[model samples]
Target: MSQTTIQISQELQQELNRMKLFSRETYEEVIWNIIEDTKELSNEAKRDIAKARKEIAEGKAVTLSDLREKYKIQ
Candidate 1:
């Protein structure tokens, strides 16, 4: 890989270092993990997920056989 140089404050460097799981992890990995973890879902998507989860938790989910029996589908 081609190498490039960038500069960050010592405080930022320390924060990145603290975020690392191991002493040998690269700053690139640390920054990428922070980036991936910071992803946000839309409000609508979040609401749908919450609703689906609640249905499953409340035993409101149905199997194909249950639906077939309920509707008496042949």
Candidate 2:
């Protein structure tokens, strides 16, 4: 939405310049990858929450002690 300049270490900048890593294709692919990963995690979180709510509504939920006993954990 807005343009801003980010400062980086001179050594890192020099490395990027030397490698010519500022290509449009590289930037586009990186952004696309980040968005895709975020979407997948969001969907997974929603599914897990829905499952928990369903379990609670169906009276299948347990208390902390129940969980500890079920798992045999201290």
State each model's CA lDDT, in order: 0.94, 0.71
lDDT of 1 by residue, 45-70 (tens): 89999999999999999989998999
Residue-by-residue lDDT tens digits, candidate 2, 1-74: 57566677899666555544356444335546657767745788889999999999999988899999999999
Which 10-residue span in candidate 2 carries the lowest summed lDDT?
19-28
Error of 2 at 17 (Å): 36
Clashes of 1: 0
- Work out the TM-score per prediction: 0.56, 0.33
Which numbered prediction scores highest in TM-score against the true structure? 1
Indicate which candidate wins on lDDT: 1
Misplaced by over 4 Å in model 1 are 41-52, 59-74
